[model samples]
Target: MARVLIAPADTRLSNLRYGKSYNVLNNMTADDVTIDALVGEEETAVEAQNVHVRELGTQNRLQYYGRSFRTAAREIRAGSVDIYHHMNLSYRWFNPVLLAGIAADTPTVLGPCQTGHAIMAEEFNNMLSQAVGYELPLPVSNAVYYPMNAVRDVTIDPVRMSLFRRTLEAADRITVVHEEAREAYARHVDESKIDVIPLGVDAELFEFTERQDTQTLVAIGRLEQRKGYDVLLDALANVVEAFPNVHLDVFGEGPEEQALREQAASLGVADNVTFHGYVDQSVVRDHLARARAFVHPSRSESFSLVRLEAMAVGCPVVVTETAGAHEMVRDGKEGFVVPTEAAEPIADALLELLSDFELTRAMGARARERVERNYDWRAIGQQYVDLYRSLL
Candidate 1:
C-alpha cells in the first residue's frame, strides 16, 4: 500500500464540524493507500500512532510565518512518505510543506484552496455605503480602491506571495473545489496544473427524513458579512408578509450575530427568525431533515459542504448563482439559484417552495439523489487515490 502523508493546519482534527480537513483525511484511507498526518500541535490528550504533532509556538505574526514553516519543513523531511498532500494552502502558511515536498523529491498535491472573490469587495462596499447612508464619489472611491486592489492582486504580503508562487510552481497537481476557484488559482500558476475536485459530504450521516409539512427555512453557516445573512434577513422580511407562520432557523455564530438580530428586529421579522447559535451536527441534520427548504445567500463560497449536507437530508436548497455548490444543484430542478445579494429573488424562491408542497417534495428528492450520485465521501476519496496513482 502507498503511504501518503497528509499535512493540515490542525493535527488534532479539532474544529471538524466547520472544516473538511478531518473528513478528507479520515475518508482517504483505502485498500490501495494508507494515511499518516503531520499536524501543527497536539490539541487533545488522545494520541494516535499515524499522527505526528509539533508545537510551532506561533503566537505572533512573525512566529506564525517563520516558526510554522521551519517546523513543518523538519517534519516533512524526516518522514519517508511517497506522496505529500497539503490541505488549506494560504498566502501565509504551508510554505514549509511545499518546501519539504521539494526536498524529499515527492509528488505534491496542494489543494482545494480558494481565494477572495472580486465581486464581494464591490458588493460589500455598496452595502456599507447603504448602511452608512452615503455613497462615496465614483472618482474618489476609484482613486482609493484601485491601488489597493492592485496591491492585493500583486501581493497581500511580500514573503507570503513569494512562498505562494514557489508552492504553485513546485506542486505536481493542484486541486480546487469549483470552477471559479480553479480560475482564481490560475492567476498565480499554470491553468493546466489545476483540477476541480469538490469537497464531499458524508451522506449516511445526513440521512433523508420525510417532512413536507414544515414551514421552516434553514440557513447554516457562520454569521459573517460575506455570508450575506443580512440579505437573507431582508428576504425573510418579505417572506413573512405572505406566510406569517413561516419561520427561519439560522445555525452557527460569528461577529455578525448581534447585527443580524438587530436587522431582524428593524425589519419587524424578529419573532419569525430563530438564531440557534452553533448547534451540534445532529441538531443540524435534524433541522435539515425537517425544514421545508435550505436558503444560503452567501456572496461567495469555494464549495459549500453545508448545502450538500442539506441536500443529503432531502432538503431543497435556494442559493446564490455564484456559490460553488450551485453547480451540484440544477436550478429549478433541485431548487432555485437567484442573483447574489438580491432579496426579492431569494424571497420569491423561498415562497415558491414553501407554498407548493408537491413541488418542494419532488425537488428535495432530486436533491438527495444528486448528493448520493456526486458528493459521497467514499467516491471523492477514490478520486484522490486515482490522482495519486497517476502521479506515481
Candidate 2:
C-alpha cells in the first residue's frame, strides 16, 4: 500500500468551489492507498484521518513563500509518508510544497493549479470600473485594481518563480483541471509531465430532482466581481423583458453584496431577483434541483465545481466560454457558453431556455447523464489512484 501525504493551503473544507484539496483527500479511498493530510493552522476543522495541522506562525501569507516551504519541509521530513501530493501550488506562496517533497526525497504530485492571473486581474478591473462607472488608464488601472500583484511581484514573484522552477523540475507528475491551466503551467515545466484531471462532483448529493414549472434561474458563487453577478443581473434585466415572470436566486455572500443589490435596482430587476445570501450546500443543491437553469457569468474560472453540481442535479447550465469548466459542457448539449463579460448573449441563452420547457428538460437530462459518466467522485478518485501508482 502507498501511504500518501496530502498538503493543502487550507484544510477546513469550506471552499467547496475552488479549494478542492479537501475533496481529493475525501474521495481518494482506494484500498491500495492510505492518505494523511498536512494542513495549515488556519483550517478550523479536519475530517480526514492522520491529519497534521501545523501552526505556520506569523508568516502565513503567500508572499512568504520560503517560510511556507521551510515549515512544510520540516513536517514532511518528520512524517513516514511515501508520496507528497500538494494542491493549489499556483498561488506562488505555496511553492514550498515542491521543496518539501525534494527535501524528503518523496515523489511529488503538484497542482490542479489554475490561474490566468493577468486575465483575471484585467477582468476584475473591468468589472470594478463598470460598477463604479469610470475607467482608469491600463497601466494605472492594473496597479490600482490589482495591488496584490504588485506586492507579489515585489516580494513573492521573484522568489516564487525561482522556487517554482525547482519544484516543477523535481515533481514526478503535475495535474491541471483544464487546458487553460495546463497551458499556463507549461511555460515552467515539461508539458509531458502534466495531466488534465477535471474536478468531480458528488452525484448522489446533488442528485437530479424533477424541475418545478417556474421561471426561476439560479446562480451560486461568492458575490465577487470576478463572479460577474453584475453582468448576470444585467442579463436578467433583459431576460425579464422576454419572460416577465423570470426570477433569479443568488446564493452566497461577499463584499459585493450591496453593489449587486444596487445594480439589480438600477437595472429595474430588483423585484425579479432574490439574494439568498450564503446558503448551505444542501440549500444550494435544492435550488439547483428546482431552478429552470443554472447561470454563471464568471469572468474567469479555473474549474467550476458548482456548475458540475448543477449539471448533476438535472439543471442545464449557462456558463462563460472562458470558464475552464466549460470544457466539461458541450455547448447546446448540456448548456450554452457565452462570451465572457457580455450580458446580451447571456440574456439570449436564458430567454431561449425559459421559452421552451421541452428543450430545457432535454438539456437538463443530458447534463445529468454527462456528470454520471465523467464527473463522479468515485471515478475521479480512481484516476488519482492510478497517478499515485505510476509514481510508485
Candidate 3:
C-alpha cells in the first residue's frame, strides 16, 4: 500500500463545488494506499487518513515556518509516504518543505499546471521578495501571460522566476498539462524529465443533451482582457448584420465585467449579447446543454476544461489558434480555430458553423468522440498514478 502526500494551492480539496481538478488524486486512491492533503484551515474533515489542515489566524494566510514544515515532514516520513506531489506554485514561504522532503529522501513531483518554466519562475521571484525582501537568481522558466487586473502589464515578475526555479530544482520529476507547457519547460529543463498529461474531464457529466436550434453561441471564462470578450464583441458587431437572430451568452465574472458590458453596448450589440455572470458549475452545465455551440477566443490558455466540457456534451467549439485549446481541438474535424483578435475571421468562422446544421452536428459528434477517446478522468488518474509510482 503506497502513501502519497498531495499538496494543493488553496482550500479546494474540501470544496467539491470547485474541486474539479481533484479528479486526478481523489479517484486514484486505493484501499491500501492512503491519500492525504495539505489544505487550508476552513476545509472540513477530509475522508483520507492523513489530513493536515493548516491553522491560520484571522489573517487567513498560513504562515510557513521551518519547524512546522519539518514536523509535517516527520509525520509523512513516519507514515512512509511513497511520494510528495507539489501542486501549488513555488512559494518561498514553503521552501523549508522542499528542504525537508529532500532530507527525508522523499521523491518530489511538481505538477506544472500550465506553462511551468516561465510562470513558476516569475511567481518564485514574487514570493521570494515578499518573504525575504531580497532578489535571487531564478532557475526555471515557467512564465504565463494573460491580461488580468492583478498583472495588466503582460510581464512575469523576476522574483517569481527565482522561487519557481528553486522549487523545480527540488522536484524529481515535473508533469505538464499540455504540449505548449512541455515546450515551454523544455526551454529551461531537461526534456527527458518532463512529461505531458493534458487535463481530462468527466465525459459523463458533459454528455449530449437536447439543445435549441436558435442561432445562439456561448463563451465561458473569467471576464478578463486575456479572455478576449472585447474581441468577440468586436467580431459580433459585424456578425449580427448577416444573421440578426444570432445571440451570445458570455458566462463568467471578473474585474472587467462592467467594461465588457459597456463595450458590447458601444458596439451596438448589447441587445444581442447576454451576460450570465459566473453561474454555478451545475447551472453552467445546464446552460451549455442548451447552446448550439461554444466559442472561446482567449489569447492564451494552458488548456481549457470549458472546451472539453462543451465537447463532452456534443457542442462544437470555435476557438482562436493562439490558445492551448488549439492542441485538443482539431481544426474542421472537431472544432474550428481562427486567427487571434481578427474580428472578421471569427465572424466568418461563427457564420460558417451557424449556416450548416449538418456540419455543426458532425463537428459536435466528433468533439465528443475525441474527448471520450483521449480525455476521460479515470484514464488520466491512472496516468498520474503510474507517474508517481515510477519515481518511487
Candidate 4:
C-alpha cells in the first residue's frame, strides 16, 4: 500500500465541501496529516492515519488555508509520509513556505479544486496571476468579509512566492479535480506533469429520496456575483408570473446576500424566494429531498458540489453553460444548461421543467444515475488512491 500525506488549506477533516477531498483520499488509504478538522470526528476515525491542527492563529482562519500547508507539511515530514496532496491551492493564498520543504524532498501533487476551466478566462487568468504575485487589482469578495482579497498579498508575499515557485518547478505531478483546470494549469506550468482527476462526493449521503413536494425550487452555494443568484431572482420573477406556486429557496451565505434579497423584492418575487442563509450540512439533505428541482445559474464555477449533491438526490438540475457543472450534466438527458448571463433563458428552463412534471422526474432519475456511477465518493475515492499509488 502507498502511504500518502493530505494537506488542505481548510481543515479538510471537518469542512463540508472541501473536506470531501480529504475524505475521498484517506478513506481506504493512509493519510499522514489532515489539519483543522476539515473532516468530522467520525470521518477522521475511519481513516487509518489522522492528525489535527489546533492553532487558530491568523493563518488557520477560514481565509488562510495556505498557512496550514506548512504546518501540515512539517507534521507529514516528521512522520515520513511518501506523497503530499494539496487541495485547492489555486483558489487562495497557498503559502510557498510549507511547499518548499515538500518540493525539496517528497513527490507532491496540488489539486486545483475550484472550477477547472474558469482559470482559462482571460480576465480570470490575468487576475489570478496578479493574485499569485500579491498584486490583485480586483477587490476581495467572499463570504463573511469586506475585503476578501485582503490576506492575499500578505499570505503570498515574496518569501511565500519563493517557496511556491520552487515547489511548482520541483513537484513531480500537478493534479486538478476538474479536467478543464488541468488544461488551464498546463498553460502556466508544465503540461506533461499535469493530471486530471475528478473530485468525488459521498453519494449515499445525498442519495435520492422521493418527495411529493412540487412547488419548491432550491439553489445552494455562496451568495456572490459568480453564483448569479441575482439572475436567478430575475428569472424567478418571470417564472412566478406564470406559475404562482413556485417558491425558490436559496441555501448558503456570502457577501452578496443583501443585494440578492433586494433584487428579489424589486422583481416582485420576494415572497416567493426564501433565503435560507447558511445552514448546517446535516439539514442540507432535508432541503434537497424536499425540493421540486435544483437550479444553479452560476456565471462561473470550477466544479459545483452543491449541484452534485442536488443531483444525487434526484433533483433535475438547470445550470448555466458557463459553469463547470455543465460538463457533469448531460443536457436534455440529465438536466438543462442555458446561457450564463441571461435571465430569460433561465426562467424559460425552469418553467419548461415545471410545466412537465414527468420530464423533470425522468431527467432527475438520469441525474442520480450519472452521479451514482461516476461521482459517488467510494468510486471516486478509489480513483484518487490509484493516482496516489501510481505516482509512488
Candidate 5:
C-alpha cells in the first residue's frame, strides 16, 4: 500500500470546488492507497474524513519560527510518506506548497494546476478599469496596464526559475486540469511527465433535478471582474427586450459587488437581475436545478466548476469557450459555448434557450448523463490512487 499526503490551501472540504472532490478522495481507499494531509495553519482541527489532516506551520499568517514548515520537512524526509500530492486549487496563479520544500524532498504529484493562461492586454486593462474605476475620475487603467505582464515580470519567471524548477525536477508526475495548461507547463518542464486530469464533481450530490421552463437564468462564483458578470448583465439587458420578464440570479460576493450592481443598474437590467451575494451550495444547486439555464461568462477559467455542477443537476449551461470546462460541454448539445468577453453571443444563446423549451430540456438531459459517466469523483479519485501506485 502507498501512503499519500494531500495538501490543499483550505482543510475544510465543504465548498463545491476542490473541497468536494478532495472530500470524496479522502474516503476512497481503493488500490491499496492511504491518504493523509498537511495544511499551512489550521486554527482548530476540524472533522476530516478517512484521512488525517495536520497543520504545517504556526497559526500566524506569516511563517512563524518556520516551526510547521520544519515539521513538514522532517515528515517528508523521514520517508514514511510515499507521495506528496500537492493540490493547488486555492487560486489560479501560484502554489506556495512547492516553495515549502516538501515537494523537492519527496516524490510529488502537483496540480490540477490552473496556470498557463494568457489574458488579453486590452481585456485585462478593461477588467482593472472596472475593478478600481469606482472613484477615479480619469481612466487610470494605463497607469499599470496588463497585470499579466506585471505578474510575469515580478513573479512567474523568477518563481519558475527557482521554486517551480525544483518541484518539476523532483515531481514524479504533474497533472493539469486542461490542455491549455499543458502548453503553459511544457515551456518550463518535461512535456512527457505532464498529464491532463481535469477536476471532478460528485454527480450524486448534485443529482439531476427536472427543471421548469422560465425566463430565469443563473450565474454563480465570486462577484469579481473576471467572472464577466457585467457582460452577463449586458446580455441580460439585450435579453429583456424580447422577454421583459427575463430574470438573472447572481450569486456570491467580492470586490466587484458594487461594480456589478452598478453595472446592472446602468445597463437597465436591474429589474431583470437579482444579486444574491454569498449563497450556500444548496441554494446554488437549487437555482441550477430550477432555473432555465446556467450562464458562466468568465473571461478565463482553468475549469469552471459551477458549470459542471450545473450539468450534474440536469441544467444546460452557456459559457465562454475560453473556460477549460467548456471543452467538456458540447457547443449546442450541452449548452452554448460563446467567445470570451463578448455579450452578443451570450445574449443570442440565452435567446435561443428562452425561445425553445425543448432545446433546454434536451441539452440538460444530456448534461446530466455526461456528468454521471465522466465527472464522478469515485472514478476521478482512482486516477489519483493509480498515480500514487505508479510513483511508488
Candidate 6:
C-alpha cells in the first residue's frame, strides 16, 4: 500500500469556499491507498471512514490556511509517505517557503487550485461603476474599497508570483480546477506537468428534480463583487420588464450585501427579488431544484461550484464567459453562456428559458446527465488515485 499525505485548506465544511475540498477529501478511499489528512480541527479529529485525520490549526480562519501550509512544510516524516498532496491552493504568501521539504521529497502534488486570471484596470473600474450606480453616497459606494484592493493586488502580485514560481519549481505534478487555470499556470510551469481536474459533484446528494416551470430564476453565491450579484440584479430588472411576475432568489451574504440590496431597489426589482442571507446548503439546493433557470453573471471567476450544484439539481445555467462553469455547458444545449458583466445578454438568456419551459426541461435533463457522466465524485476520486499511482 502507498501512503499519501493530503493537506486540505479547510475541513469544517462551514463556508462554501471549502465545499469542493472537503468532498474530495472524504471520497478519496482506495484499497491500495493509505490516506493521512491534516484537517481544520484544533483538538478534535473528525471521523472519515478511510482517512486518518489530524489537526494542525485551531480553526480555518482567513490567515490560518496560509499558516497551516507553513506548518506543514516545517513538519513531515521524510520518506515515510509516498506522496505529499497539497490538496488546497498553493499560491499564497508563505505557502511555498519550505514546500519541497515534505515527505518523499520530489514526489509532491500541489493544487486542484487556481490563481484567478488577471483583472485589468479598465475592467475593474467598469464593474464597480456599474455596481455602484448614479446615487453615490460616501458610505454606499464600494468605489473606495476597490482602490485598497487594487493596491493590495498590486503589492501582493510580485510576492505571490515569486512564491508560486517556487511552487512550480518544486512540484512534481500540479492540478488545476479548470482549463483556463491550467493555461494560466502553463505560462510558468511545463504544460505536461499540469492536469485539469475540475471540482466534482455528488449527484446523489444533489438529486435531479423536475423544474416546475415557474417564472423564477435562482442564483447562489456570496453577495460579493466576484460572484457578480450586481450584474444579476441589472439583468433581473430587465427580465421583470418583460415578465413582470418574474422573481429572483439570491443566497449568501458578504460586505457587499447593503450595496446589493440598494442596487436592487434602485433597479426597481426589489419587489421581485428576495435576498436570503447566508442560508445552509440544503436551502440552496432546494431553490435550485425548482427554479426555472440559474443565472451567474460574474465579472471574474475561475470556477463556480454553485453552478454545478444548480446543474445537478436539474436547472439549466446561464453563466458568463468569465466563469469557468461556462465550460461545463455546451452553449444552448445545457444553457446559454453570455458575455461577462452584461445585463442584456443575461436577461436575453433568461427570457428565452422563460419563453419555452420545454427548453428548460430538456436542458435540465441534459445538465444532470452531463454531471453524472463527467463530474461525479466517485469518478473524480478515481482520477486522483490514478495520479497517485502514476507518481509512485
lDDT of 6 by residue, 1-392 (tens): 88787765453543243366666766676788887777666233334466677666455344445565665655454346577777766444334434444543547888787766445443454435444433344443346655657687678677778877777767788888877788788888799999988888878989999989799888877666777788888888888988999999888776688998899888888999898998777888888887999988777776777778888989999998874655688899889998886889999999999999999999999999989988887778778888998998
For candidate 5, give the lDDT: 0.72
Backbone-clash count (model 2): 1
TM-score of each: 0.81, 0.82, 0.80, 0.76, 0.82, 0.84
lDDT assessment of candidate 1: 0.75
lDDT for each residue of candidate 1 in 1-392, tens digit (9 for 90 to 100): 67666554443345357446655655554566666655544444223333344444432334344554554466557766677777677534345566545444877888767765544444545534543447755455556566766786566667666777888888889888877778778888899989888888888888987756889999998887788999999999999999999999999886689999999999999999999999898999899988999999988765678888888999999999764655788899988888987999999999899889999999999999998888887677668778888877
Alpha-carbon error at 216 in model 4, in Å?
Answer: 1.8
Highest TM-score, which number?
6
lDDT per residue for candidate 5 within 42-105, as digits (tens), equals 4443343446666554333234224434554666778787777766632233345456555565
Give the better candidate number (1 or 2) by TM-score.
2
Candidate 4 per-residue lDDT, tens place, 6-30, comes to 5553332444654664555445433
Tens-digit lDDT track for model 3 on 186-284?
Answer: 665677888887777877766776446769898998787677888899989888999888899988886578999899888889999999887787877
Regions of model 2 farther than 4 Å from truth: 14-19, 41-79, 91-94, 97-101, 117-159
Span of 10 residues, lowest total lDDT, candidate 4:
32-41
Q: Specify the poorest-scoring 10-residue window by lDDT in model 2.
A: 56-65
Worst 10 residues of 3 by lDDT: 140-149
